[model samples]
Target: MSEPSGDASGNDLRRSSALVGAGILLSRVAGLVRESATAAFLGTGIGAEALRAALRIPNLMQNLLGEGVLSASFIPAYSKLLAEGRREDAGRLAGAIAGLLLLVTSVLVVVGVVFAGPITRVITPGWPEGSARFELTVTLVRILTPGVGLLVLSAWCLGVLNSHRRFFLSYVAPVAWNAAIIVLLVSVGLSTSEQFTVAQAFAWGAVLGSALQFGVQLPGVLRLTRGLRLSTSLAVPGVRAVVSRFGQVVAGRGGVQLAAYVDVVVASLLAGGALAALGYAQVLYLLPISLFGMAIAAAELPTLSTLDHEDRRRVVERIDTGLGRVAFFVVPSTVAFVLVGDLVVATVYQRGNFSEDASVQVGAILAVYGLGLLASTSSRLLQSSLYGVGDTRTPAIYAVLRVVVSLLVGIAVMFPLDAVQATSQGISVVGDVAWQVAPEALRAADAPNALRLGGAGLAFGAAVGAWFEWLLLRTRVRIVFGPTRLGGPHARRIVLAALAAAVAALAARALVETIDLHATIEGLLALGLVGSVYVLVARAVGVPEARELTGRLERLVDRRAK
Candidate 1:
């Protein structure tokens, strides 16, 4: 047997996961910069919501057909072909899938552009028809739809690359997309104060960036698929299997996308800043998931699929360590977000049009999102295990359930909180958010002065849904595979370490806030303290990942000293 290729070793799993993590880290940092520039230019104003809402509608095309579907369907099937040493079959499969994806995405692009107005209305249910923001969102959607077509093809590239274990190029390709937006936003922001004009420019930049993202990965996909045959033939070897699995996974991903659409719709119904603020908070919330959860899960899927039926015991061992590794890092992230999220959010976005209060409100939403951080991260790996075993419909069923629960809970809680609007006192003009006020704002003397914390309720609803998904996923995995509980020794140590770190960090945050330290400096100091404390406590409690991290740092330091 080779290590994951044959020996079935967990070390191979860890190394592959590290590669995925590094790629995601680079891409996420770029995305963060793009979001920061966006915050500075748009703030939580109407322009921000318009851009965010516009992206939401067209992005549905990508969301349903994107990486998740490929991961669930294509990777497992395509990877199995390679594992059997059928390179020609694998190449043909990849080409056929790519051709089909291109055709489907082309159709989506046309549908989205032609029906942009109706789609915009459906996506932002709370926005009145024919409003200026609605019209702006419609225009932006037309511009962004082609980009979605490009991004879908990018996802095809991702599937092929990930199956080949060429993880970095596919994962890092998104940097191009983020970089393009950041460049355009900064350039336009420097030259103008008109939000609508900036929004229009951003749409074009995003489309170009999406093209660049796909273009960057094309060479890699082409290189690996040397015998590639681009065709939409359903009869290609393994193509039917891929298509069958793709349908099931799309069903699962579709349910998840439905929940997200509900989130946008519900937020549109809230007071002015709900959608925009939640968008900012989500950038932070999704970072850890992308870095740790997704990286580890994605790395494991191909290997897990290869090992399916041949070595159940070895596969379960891999799952245990992957879950614990994800838990070790994610626990602290959850702690930091819940305890010091305001500090982080302020440091990242409290400049230009983004006010201090808006950052704090976004922080609160991050904290709410933090409540289910562990469960959400854990669910990814669990789902991959299910996918590895060829059970897609179960996840699809539960995904629908999760969305239903999320919408019901979110709707019940969001409207009341929306009554109290949130806005910055520094802004003399009400800006463009006037059209977004909740009904109760009409009776309030100081409606704009209210804390726009309604987004937290929505976040809380999402957190609950996350945990529900995790619990269901865990139960299914246990029944199908073996014991997949995350209550391993390392997870317990991670929890304790996170708690101790949070306590000290809270003290650090309070002391730093007492002084007049700059927001960025204060955040760095506080977050640095949290990271240091968490690692040290985890080391003392004998978490092996902590020891591994310490050893790696020591090795790097020793080498640099030379």
Candidate 2:
């Protein structure tokens, strides 16, 4: 029998993409339910705002050091070292990175706990003075800070696993964290009589969940590589080099993340609930982006690390196919969300303590975020390409540009227009200007129309900045990979398959609506049925790329069976 193609490998780009995508789908679904549960329990309240602000600081650090920034640079260097037969070097570097990360994160947790009050004040200056919100925000931050250590360690483990071509375990690890959080939530009742407030309960769950995130990956990492050994030698050849490059990458990522924090700061300066609204919006928007886009990024990395010019061309072709397919699924998704977000939000969360008015506000924010879905996904792909070529500084520069542009755009767009007043006196009318330009947050608090406009502006600014980064990266890709040579007939087939997918989705939606489906059960059924239809239709369309993806999946199952 002919040996299986590299596609047959368990951690092959396509197969791992499918696996990670599926697992992430599960995680995102649970995450949605988790957010919905939280929203229902604590809608637009002091508790919810406190939870959001508390979560933001540690989560921001995680973005910088754990997944987005750190992984991009760390994984490529680690993988390259392994690919070049420097296994010991790779293991030592991994150990060193892990040791350093653990020490730094431990210190951060202590500092965050000791200085929670001042941190919360800086993060959310408009938090009502001496209120429950302020106190709770500080408390939750202290509770959640330790997660930084667990999460950072988890990222290092995941990076090592991915470098060694063991993906399933790492991909499945997030499930444990999700399960832990769910168990905690279920164990604690929603009634006010519960021992801990919902915020406190969730805070505890986060700690347990992050522990699971790190713990689950340990066995696999141990099995797949040499044992970890820490050394005081900061001068380990590749380790120092990787860390220096990673430092630059982290600084760039930190700048962009600081911009994100700026958004939280601005929103917190608004009315009481703006912080929560923005948080909910971000969580919901990231679902599809992270699920598919990050899967493609993860899958592409190992292959990109090993490929020659022709092979690299082929890999980018596969990436294009994958990205185009995502666009088809996600574009209509964006449209549907823009059209029916209010209904979806209301249906999911309107009952219990989450009122209809709150649903309307959250849904409006979601719709604004929906506009940037494609831009975000495209940026993920382009950034992966840049990292694949071992050019970290280019992306760092692009990242800084995005931060600068977004800040300027956010300011310009958020400033309200012409706050003038007029009064009539007997025969003459007199006008007195009260304010030249109303700040958006005040206008959003007092005027809902202006709030929606401000949201639109923020969303538009974000999308513009993302696309601008993509454009710059596109030029880099052209320069690096020659002009117009990535896509092939396989790409064409994937496009046809995606077109069929759109049709299948519409058909599925129609059938569900005809039956008057409602409730979570109905929603789940509709998604399942629509997904099945898309697969079947893509199969019928003779899309070889789709077939290739499915074929590898079958082989992976067969390998496990043996």
TM-score of each: 0.94, 0.82
Model 2: weakest 10-residue lDDT segment is 420-429
Best by TM-score: 1
Tens-place lDDT per residue, model 2, 39-151, is 76776566667788888887766777786665677788888877788777777777787777777777887888899898888877655546566788888898898876688
lDDT, model 2, position 391: 74
**Lowest-lDDT window of 10 residues in candidate 1?**
442-451
Q: Which candidate number has the best lDDT?
A: 1
lDDT (Cα atoms) of all candidates against the true structure: 0.83, 0.66
Over 4 Å off, model 1: 1-8, 308-310, 420-437, 440-451
Clash count list over all predictions = 5, 0
C-alpha lDDT of residue 306 in model 2: 58
Clashing pairs in 2: none
